[model samples]
Target: MLKTAAAAATGSALSSLGLRAASASTPRRGGTLRIGLGHGNSTDSYDPATFIGGFMQAFSFARYNCLTEIAADGSLAPELAESWEPSSDAKQWVFNLRKSVEFHNGKTMDAQDVIASINHHRGPESTSAMKPVVDQIAEIRSDGPNRVILTLEHGNADFAYTLSDYHMVIAPAHEETIDWQSGVGTGGYVVDSFDPGIRAALSRHENYWKENAAYFDNVEMLTIADANARISALLSGQLDVIDRIPFATASRVKSLANVKLVEVTGSQHYSFAMNTQFAPFDDNDVRLALKYAIDREKLVQNVLSGHGRVANDHPIGPAYRYEATQLEQRVYDPDRARSLLKKAGHDSLTVELSAADAAFSGAVDAATLFREAAASAGITINVKREPNDGYWSDVWMKKPFSAVFWRGRPTEDWMFSTVYIGKSPWNDTFWENESFARVVNEARTELDEGRRRSLYAEAQALVRDEGGAIIPMFANYLSATNLNVEHPERLAASDDLDGMRLAERWWFKS
Candidate 1:
């Protein structure tokens, strides 16, 4: 729906990124897989709360395991927790942990460890993003050695899916506090070294519980925020895997037979977020004007180089459950945009929109394109290029209007609760739809599939037409990998690089 360019252009663009074809190769173990990632900061911490991009997730998978994980095909699969079930009302849940899973520190995973890890984000001093998630839990206690029970304030049919969140990684517990600096977990690999924004090293855990994964003997995850640098690393035989490949340069990367680009369509959405509390943007009509002024199709075709699909002003892409598919896509209309601006008591409105490539692959270019399109609608948008180093902390939500990207949550309720909820710290737009809040709560507890679907459909409509984020495109996860790196046919679209499990599932084709 990107309202973007022609399909041929998209195909031509993707040909370079490796989505044009698939390969059949067998997995062989015992090789070091060097990975180059496109996002991270020197301030990055070992705490799961500090995770900012796919780079962190990839690194965490090297030493930690969540209760569940998102599979290559987007299904939730058990990890540390062997089995789980919910109460009749779905307000209470119990997880049976796998026994004898040992950490690198010689500690066995137990119910107490799980309880302590959950409490880390629940403590009063905790400022974790997962705080809101665990805040819903009234109690987390152990019934026995391998049994853990979680009592919720309300029913959540998808509560199990919540455990799949990367922030919920289970770490060793000591005196009600989690000892994460040790970086020990029952994962496929053990952390040999970690330097946040620079590079990380991990070696395969000989005692890893999962018998089928962690094929590589070692892995090195490098944070290269520059696209040029990431590409150069892959082309020059420096990295075996790299993600966030630029859409415009897909062809250049694809032409290399030793490497292939991987594209998986999912819930990733790119937007120019407006501070709904600010002027001009605070007015719904003005927001609508800005929305109508941007050409989504051209953005997908020209700016995204057809590597994405047009979004309908909402973060929930078509891959999301209960998406409002029947809703008419918002189209480009400069005259209508001008009319809306005039109605908002502004014949012409001038605003500064800060952006950087780190916001998305080509955000500066997209903002420039938007500026050209809005000029016809009597709107002057000054595209301010902000530095990528502090864009996340400085310009993203701090500015009145700026660019942001949402990888999206596994569930609709999770997505809304994480970003759109009025109290969420990541509520970049400061949008609070009263009806949507009520509907999301209902959908979370509604066990009736039909009723839940209806509730989500209503919620999606409100976000698409009235939300504060101007979602221009739902992009496919694009990454370039070497010919020797072998993974599953269906890869993870929810999280980059096979759900950041490349170290676990991939192998060298020797």
Candidate 2:
């Protein structure tokens, strides 16, 4: 019920980015849409919390429905939950579930299902990456069959937006537990065959509640981690749509008569995370030296092909409401890096940087560029080209230094709580600052806009100067699709492929 006007303005923003304006036309259905993705892993799982790459994020939204959804225009909208109302303090939220919604397995979705599904990510035993978000819920209870109420431990102004996370898909409830392994949910499509890290096939759910949506008869998703392979599939007519278009090949793809390039500015960012818990990286001076050593400008021009803006060493971007734009932009300075290394009591520093294109297109090249730049500052960086197949499991977070990408959250608090918090399961850097913790926690409950922005500014400063994350650039969500596969004008900038809901929101033109 608290929809923002930002949705109405998203069309103009996308139009400026060269996305063809959508005309008013009837959508024709009944075609198999083949999608090529640049992300997936062999270690992926049925559990939503374990989802690491864009492939699983898109697949989850295609086959399962969250209580709430971030709409194509970047506004929060209802999905399984017909509507929601928040308490005056923004602590308690009550959601009214839609009636007669059936799961893929013919189970009727109700309040109990919502409760059980949410509980799957809560509790001390839960190892879900979203555990930090759900841990704020003090209690969850059903008012009736369709109404579910959640009371938070404290007032959180952005509590409702948290429910739209891809990991919050509701499943069929059975005796206080939900079955997630079966892939049964009240979504637009039902999974037919799933091969982790490779491909997935699904058919449209005939009983889907949302009418006039999900026009595709079937959807086949292919995991092509290599950037070249993904573009080849698109040009060869082997795929109808593709996500994560490589910036280097973007101009060439745009020139193809059969292709339509889609780009939207969002919170997506690329970073090099150094494990602060490990040696060498543990020293703040060493971390600052690394941060100053990399040339963000070169990465944006060379690696991103001038498609993104340089990022300060924090996750908050221009898209977020409370981005600390006033903070001094950190530029590459070899002398500063050397001074920081000396302050850390190191004459020279050497470290291996693990990278792969699976992290993002041109990630390995970015690592090589970073190595060359760091050499000027008495830092020796060894670029390790890791295999793309199991990079999420074997390299990311597991390795001391690695390339990573994030399809950032809609809200600042959600992003920080997920990856920057001390106890966050997906805190790849494993770094925490006391000042950051205090400001972020306080800002979560601060309802005043001016006061909240000030608190968040302090929080961003803390993360920029003290955290182990080296955020180099914020990239736009660039995708490519054949002209035959039609979509809405205002695409969601939240995640790639229309906020990872392309399978549900898009349709064939013929």
Candidate 3:
């Protein structure tokens, strides 16, 4: 017999154990899927340009469809566009939209909708995080009702994969403008009702293009920012599934026969970001001193409860094809940390770092742990607890230093382009390195694997040594669900919770 799914991760071997229930079951449809997520704010919107949190992305995936999407095994699959072709140079590309695809508003989806939805993030007025990812698009023209041609500023083999981005939601276009506020698209569900961060409901789209999808008649997304509360909801049968269960309380799932804990390791990592433009952090020595102070091993063992692996400060994880693992790991050294702090001319440094559990499971506790460890190096971190309601808008990027988590991108260049590129909207650190930026642009088109690896290795070194981030551990995407919530084997590892597309792919057992 073929090996099936197994529960309880035995170290790193638990890669997408939830996707395989060990025993296969045919999908049964027609029930509301109540999902509880760890974070969401009143700031959530239907506008694709403003979707920052995974909760919003989760809801978006239910109500909207992308041109392309990452399949169960992390390969590209057609969603709206049935097929695509690229020029020999890999710069100019064309997509042929799937026929008979109808929007929730009963409008025909054409190449114009794709062009307008994409341009919403490209223009100068757009402050979206996805701005940098699409900045390379020099132009987009419609060849006809069914075809759209995209011309890039440079050659990129990953151009098609980039279309699978959650931000690339295709909306119904009326003239040159698309009504993003309506939440109408060609997804598997239709927006039944929405209240920003509170809760939203979606009904199955009867005309959904994919027959296997829309299995659940209705789906509901709830914002349960507290970790314990999210797990409690699942245990109480109030929720069918919950994402990002606190690592410490993960064992609670094992005792419940109907509730199962799932773990998938990929590029998901929790990090603390510092504004490089801010005082003290502006000094490279100060950044290095802080990076040296964190005990990554203890973080995985103590804070994460052995649910994750130590990270090397770069966003790249072991899952990515070009992820660099040859570099020496950064170890915890208080004496070395103090030496660097003194070198930076700060004998006893005091700083404020805002934190909340909403940023990630155990984030507040993680900061408290860091505070205790950093005190040994004569560094003072004032951990200010922020409210979950407005943490994303008020505290996150606005604060000089804060704790946050990143579900790493599918590709190295995409990760660098989003957060490390100069003048990019999502450059949380406000860090701009000339050499790293140059390498990011060149490596996108570099077909040679050896040459690409060398470039990425150098970039990783720069981030590890000079960048304003403290990456302690790359986390396993730990979740818990009632047995009634069924999913397929070999789920997408592009990001946590099946790239936040669980609403469409997962169905009720009944």
RMSD to the true structure for each prediction, in A, is 5.6, 2.1, 4.4
For all candidates, the clash counts are 9, 0, 1
Each prediction's Cα lDDT score? Answer: 0.83, 0.87, 0.82
Instruction: Report the C-alpha lDDT of model 1 over 97-158, residue by residue, as the tens digit.
Output: 99999988889989999998888878567678777777889998999989999999999877
Judging by lDDT against the true structure, name the best candidate.
Answer: 2
List the pairs of residues colliding in candidate 1: 1-310, 2-309, 2-310, 3-297, 4-297, 5-301, 16-254, 17-261, 18-261
Q: Name the 10 consecutive residues with the lowest summed lDDT in model 3.
A: 1-10
Tens digit of per-residue lDDT, candidate 2, span 146-206: 9999999998878878888889999898776889889898889999999988899999999
TM-score, every prediction: 0.94, 0.96, 0.94
How much does candidate 2 score in TM-score? 0.96
Clashing pairs in 3: 5-22
Model 1 alpha-carbon miss at residue 327, Å: 1.1
| Candidate 3 residue spans exceeding 4 A from truth | 1-19
Model 3 earns a TM-score of 0.94
lDDT at 507 for candidate 2? 88
